[model samples]
Target: MKMMAMALRRITLSPWQTALTALTIPSTTTTTTTTRPHSTLMSPPVVSLDLPDVWPPNSSHFHFPPPINYSNGHRAAVIDGKLIAEEIRSRIGSEVRRMKESIGKVPGLSVVVVGQRRDSEIYVRNKIKACEQVGIMSTITQLPDDCTEEHVIDAVSSFNVDPSIHGILVQLPLPQHLDEGKILDAVSLEKDVDGFHPLNMGNLAMRGREPLFIPCTPKGCIELLIRSGVEIMGKKAVVIGRSNIVGLPTSLLLQRHHATVSVIHAFTKNPEHLTREADIVITAAGVPNLVRGNWLKPGAVVIDVGTNPVEDPSCEHGYHIVGDVYYEEAVRVVSAITPVPGGVGPMTVAMLLLNTLDSAKRAYEFS
Candidate 1:
């Protein structure tokens, strides 16, 4: 019987035969007994039932195991941008303290705001608060909403040559009359911590030449992606939106990291098809829910840059900030997705402080 069982095990069984054996065998049985044509005595089964399937079998029967859930899995290391920024700021503050002790001068950051847009004001105030907390000298130059482009440019030019000021940032979304391009170009590249200068952009585009400062918001986005361990090298990255502020620089940065990048603008035909094929998607279109759930590939990493405020009467503020990608829809599909308000926004402010600190270090040559 054991010999018969061994012979039966040696012969490859069909799926149906295996199912019949399993169905006929009792779960509590320690061994199987069978009779062969030449032998009547029963013997122990020679093959162990615990053995797994051997290779070179039917190709149609093969299937890959399901992927492990990493989006909500236990992270090996938390990418706390806020904590990292705090550590960087503390280091900067200590260095500033040392510089003051040695050279009798400290780094100063000047913020220029041309309008009273509530959001802009809050951003500027937050920047100033960050500077104060870091012990970096901060100054705010506020101009009326009616201020001409000439007035804004003159203020920037003055800060450009000021020996005491190490960094300068001009709040964005200036009054409609102001030529934002010209104003940004007016700030000296050395002090342009906001990194909107044409020279900085040119250097950023060039190979082997690093920009004096990368734009804060885009820098933050890249930092988040990298620290989260998302693979960038040799992956397809799609950036939606081409604004010089975020999309263009971000695409360049991703290219620097060796990603195959494609930039899709408002006019791009079949944007959803392109996004669906990407391993990574970065949306800065400022259009609410422009990147739908179906546009994302499974396991793709999503970075949402838009912070559009839509009316929400249930909230105390009567509005809620949303990203270009629909959060509810994206989280269900993508491997990882960043929240709108708490995602890239805080990191942007943090990177601004980092740039300011870099400007200070460069100005004073503080080791």
Candidate 2:
């Protein structure tokens, strides 16, 4: 029982724990908070502040640079996710430097990769690169494709107790021979930067509870929407796909922002019909061109999370990536849209850095 109490206290110190609390509790000035009864989906507590009603109520903290070099030829404003991601990374880098200077400590991330899948290798490589750019120390434990589940668990356990390591990530899609759930459960809750732990997901689903870390991809989707100045509260949002990684958590996040959300999956009939009525659409169906122009409501904001590889001999690589929504058609219809390659991809990595930095701050009790 003593061990469990200690663990619970550690989880409560996550930086995200205060994101809603800051707004929910009124201040001395003209700010007032009005919270309704919690719904089944656990909508966030709504607060009315004296400041402007923007996507991110606390934009002053980020000091985001003005959007630049965006494509304007289309009817819809192209959301430059890559540029926003760069800006976020810059802020994270600065914060990392400050932490090191004040406390003589930097964030550290550990990744355990089991297989030799080409896509997984690229993902791991990009994560390591992002850590390097943000001044975070990263270590990798590469196991053979046929390694036993115990081997993977042992590696993760080693990092969990390491004071120097603030984040522990186990690369997904483990070998068929391994038990994925057991391996994931082996990661300590305090260091589960991937946010796949059951406890973290449970907190995310509850009304007043906050997760230590939001899953990187889902968190990235929300960041893209907020930076683009899309108003989420009281809007009709539709999520395509219901996978644990990007789809399910994303819908939950949208609800947290007070958006009325609908989810479309393989079993859902006439998915496009439901999508066409949404003010905002986030599709991660992984089926390229699944969402066409006709599927969207005019003036709707679209975030394409799908990155399906299609053969393109004309391109430098053997294949090129396409999104669930057909861009050429979407650009002309929606008021705003994120392109496939430059959209959610970079934001995912940036969010990981943010989570790692937050973890380290909690570990060292840094402000």
Candidate 3:
């Protein structure tokens, strides 16, 4: 939990403190330094982007709880993951430099990407770029969409045995023909930086046990809550979706922090009813605009993990990224919410770096 230790240090910020500083500062304000133990994870001094412009029109069924007045007239404070990630990367760069100076070693990450899915490739590219920014050596093993399961497993296995590679990640959503579970299980537990190994999941699920590495996306979600000064202990949380990569682990992590968590999936009845009771909501269903305004409880803190792309012929890319929760409606109801592109997405990369660094620390016996 060393990486989590950094996040735990900042969970003490009070609601009033968050209200006062959350989104009050303008986007142009200079970033400020802090003495907090995990200050690097804190929301930056200024809002990275204005919410009203990025978010859509909103309405909420529950209004008993007064909204925190962000300076920009948005009811909810934006959890700017981009700025937070920059801080984390800056800190990691410093640590990597320190490690190299002290032990003549740096972390290395190997990614095994299968298939030509545009989203998967883009994500892998971002991961490689992030690794470079933090001084981690990264290598990518790309395979064709038609590659056999054994080919993907061999790719992961090679990295596992490579002493220089401290972390190994298998880019998700493998080809339909491949057995994903078998391939993931093939990764050595020690180098499973993506934390997909069954052992890691088991450790995460059990009490009095901790995984060698936590899954990055779930770890990032908690970091967002911590960095945003949202208290998790004793709060009601609802997680939509139950994928191993994000949802199930997120719900487990929330429970670790003493939150009462409910999970909603495709089979669930009255998903909105379960969601509205949560103080914190994390949606990763991958269905765009699945969680509407009425699904949220007033004053709830939301982390939108969904990154579905919607085609928009007008946009340059012809597609725009969006979260599972409807930004427009949820913004008005929730006291705090993370935007799709600028929220949990960046934190995921940051946490991956942290995990790789941690694995290197273990391998090198660096404090």
Candidate 4:
């Protein structure tokens, strides 16, 4: 197999080799002297060809481990999303306190949850708890699972007009009976803190135009990479999955940072090949273990956005959340890999609060 691989590599370069050899020729030297007084003779430029005695000769070999060290010694610093999130919330709390003292108004975030999705409920609860921690008023408008589309739209419209509600988020994956798109559209651009509104998405897509809010998960991923001092500019980045909420927007954001981005979707052939060639890989495919160790380049930074719950007989909950990456394999190959439950998930909630605080600051002219 190794011999075949080496043969293929050589065959692929033969055409270029012939072209290069055709352009090379022996050179002869000549001496010339200027007519001006006291001018010295000069030799013609010598173009020497210094070819190695053997092509493809071995000089030195070096091994570079993954950029991130996940050993127990450094595991404590792998990144505590929960702790960092709390720090951000505390900062927001102080800002909120100051805003209330000087402007007499604190930021408020209203969440409209329709139907009963257990996971959605948990997410919403966490968001509310985060709001309370940051001193931001939290309100939840819960509607019945059987509620009509009009009812949901009306709730969103009401929140849109309420000056007290600076940010609004409608829990996703609404009932099958409702139109998710229309309901999300009803949210006013200014208060669409989830940043799903077409207007907001458009603003984010346009060059030189910043959206009032960017989607929490993608923003969090970027923040994680940036905070880690990852080099993004001019690097080859591959984003697996093309969903508007994560993959596509994430690629666009990376592009904004001047990274050459290749978006891979289900139809792409040999997706791993592309990923292995990338310097950075962002996977939001929601499939556990979708990416493996051998598919990564050494020192590559991996951001796993999937939060899939897999049955785990050993776990107390009978299941556990895992990211799209095969963490064990990835940690060995990648320089840094975000864990499933403690990575992007917590960051998402943190960024939501950030967007809320930003909205508040803008609404009250406190910037």
Candidate 5:
């Protein structure tokens, strides 16, 4: 490694740098930061701080630019996702009320689950309950483990044509006998609130094409970053894991927001080197404590999406949920982070509700 000495300012990303490359910024008052280059649209931008551009809490969005200083000064600010999600659900409830008054109906979501996996069952139950809490009508079609593919198709087909059903969700990890892709494809594109449809994903990846719905988890990751006042544009971001469900889409989302994104997966060499350079890090690798404190750029905004259950004899449940990041270590090193259970989890559910609300509005041609 070449040894050099230079002044390093705050490791925060710059919005203007990431927002649009073709447009030029007037040479004026701005804070500048510099970092190593990457193979992407931008060399690490020198961030220009414009504090007024930060969104006030009451504005259309939530933003609190960092370096965020808490009383203690060293530990990362834990993102309160449960609180943010509650705010989103409240907004959705108000919209549902308005739609009911104007159109005589509100949004509805249908969940199709096959077999009786305990984990899936709990997820479905929570989803249905969240729907109720947000004033969205929900239906669950429980099929047996031995159910035929035809039965699954029929259930999806029924929802596809139903006038009041605004969104269709197929609970994941279907029984071994079922054809997952075939079933996912059967859901109508218009009602695919889960956003797993091939067309939707394609729209997400392409410029000038807006997706009807973004996958909930990826969408949630972006939302957390935005809400927490973490800039995406012109920053270097690293995503661990390349699964379609979270990591791939999340990388795409970060790139779309103008961040240079690197995806570190099983095949990636010297993953820690790349990760340590990122201004933002999102890991969904599902390996407990896979990311340690040293694998992060100081002041980097981290959104941990992994929710791996590890054995915990002290706990009554015999296990506990932990994220890919080692929270204790990360807290002392990073600027901000989301806790395992309360972080991305609640946001995922909230986005599902919002997607359903959007689907209903689209269905009725309601603004």
Candidate 6:
């Protein structure tokens, strides 16, 4: 099996180097350069944000200028995932219509839910709704938690052979009684638009090969960066976590785009220091607000894939969804950032639609 290129060099910092990189950006600009006191290891780095117009005056700002928008008001540009996802879906809808008119076939997506988990149900419902809005046929098959592995596989097998179904997804977090891997392995790869099949993963990891589908969330993260005009080629990028679904695949995709990549997981020491060296950061670690402003390189672009719920007394639900990066702090520091609830969630669904549409076109050889 091909491996993702290990190109991200580990960084060691001196006292001055640490001070220069970790300093907090000032809310305003200044005419003269200034130096800042070094912060202790226990505290975040503090540097003078006020740099003189003259070059090499006070401190080095990550070898790059502070974000253009940050100087205006310490306000980072908000990447609106909702609008981008909506436009993608609209374009998919138009393509679906064209395919249907010319080839007499529309895309179809089938979601197989194994149990009554509320979260799984909600996800399936949203997916089905998205398919509907895009004019793709949606099918849902809900089995009981006690259902045997064979039973679930049987459902998948039926969808695999059915002429009407073009894409098949087995809702994740299968009950404890079932073998998730065996069942997932049974799904025909051609219909595996989720891109979870081992072959697809292998293709994604190989330099010259291509996966039939890129996993939705990671694809969405890259889409947001590309659409927002963040350069990826020859840039430094860090992806937090190493899960097969998000982190591992995301790192591979970044490498495919020619960005030098690093993946920091629970085992990584001083993750903040490594992250601060990156020009582009895509964080999928589930821990809520795990990334702070001080962890970022000034003018870095952040794409947060975490959606953790934290208690909130002010909201009606008493819970709010937040990404791994601290929004309040990161926005002021990074050049561009994505919001938790709206950032990657919508794009995942949009990519699913595109994948299903692609499946239909492949089936009919219309594309």
Whose lDDT is higher: candidate 1's or candidate 5's?
Answer: 5
- lDDT per residue for candidate 1 within 1-367, as digits (tens), equals 9999999788886675566467554444333322233444343244432232222222233232333343664322223556545665687678777888888887888999997875676578778888787778899999999999889998988998898898888999788888889899888888988887888888888889899999888888888888788889999999988888898899988888899999987545567778888998989987777776778787788988888878889977677788888777677678777777667777788788778777877877876
Lowest summed lDDT over 10 consecutive residues: which window, candidate 2? 50-59
Off by over 4 Å in 4: 1-77, 313-317
Give the range where candidate 4 is weakest over 10 consecutive residues by summed lDDT.
Answer: 53-62
lDDT, each prediction: 0.78, 0.84, 0.84, 0.78, 0.83, 0.82
Query: Could you give the C-alpha RMSD of every candidate to the true structure, in order shown?
Result: 22.8, 16.8, 18.6, 16.9, 14.8, 15.5
Stretch of 10 with least lDDT, candidate 5: 50-59
The TM-scores of all predictions, comma-separated, are 0.75, 0.78, 0.80, 0.76, 0.77, 0.77
Clash pairs (backbone) in predicted model 4: 67-335, 68-335
**Deviation in Å, model 2, residue 155 alpha carbon:** 1.4
- The digit string of per-residue lDDT tens for model 2 on 1-367 reads 9999998788663354365456545443333323333333233444332222122222223322223232555578989888999999999999999999998999999999997974577679889999999899999999999899889999999998999999999987788899877888899998989888988988998999999999999999899889889999999999998877788899999999999999987545566678888999999877778777778888899999888888888877677888888898788778999998899888888999999999999999998
Candidate 2 — number of clashing residue pairs? Answer: 0
Q: Which stretches of candidate 2 lie over 4 Å from their true place?
A: 1-74, 313-317
Q: Model 4 lDDT vs. the true structure? A: 0.78
Error of 4 at 90 (Å): 2.2
Candidates 1 and 2 compared: the better one by TM-score is 2
As for lDDT, the candidate ahead, 3 or 5, is 3
lDDT of 4 at 215: 88
lDDT of 3 by residue, 1-367 (tens): 9989989886875554555556553343234433234455445434342232112123232232333333455578999999998999999999999999998999999998887775786688889999998899999998988999888888888888899999999899787799889999999898889898999999999999999999999999998899889999998899988888888899898999999999887645567778888899999887778787777787899999988888888987788888888898788878999998899888899999999999999999998
Candidate 3 residue-wise lDDT at 303: 94
Backbone Cα, N, C clashes tallied per candidate: 1, 0, 0, 2, 2, 1
Per-residue lDDT over 113-218 for candidate 6, one digit per residue giving the tens place of the 0 to 100 score: 9878644655687798898898999989989889999899999999999988999999877898888778889988889888888898899999999899888878
Candidate 4 C-alpha lDDT tens digits along 1-367? 9999998678653553444444443232221232223545232223322221121122121122344444543221254566666777788889999999998998889999888864676689889888887789999999999999999999989888899989989888789899888999998888888888887888878898998899888888888888878899999999988776788789878988899999986545567778889998999876767776667887788888888777888987677788777777676666787877787877889899999889988888996
Candidate with the larger lDDT of 2 and 5: 2
Task: State which candidate, 2 or 6, has the greater lDDT.
Answer: 2
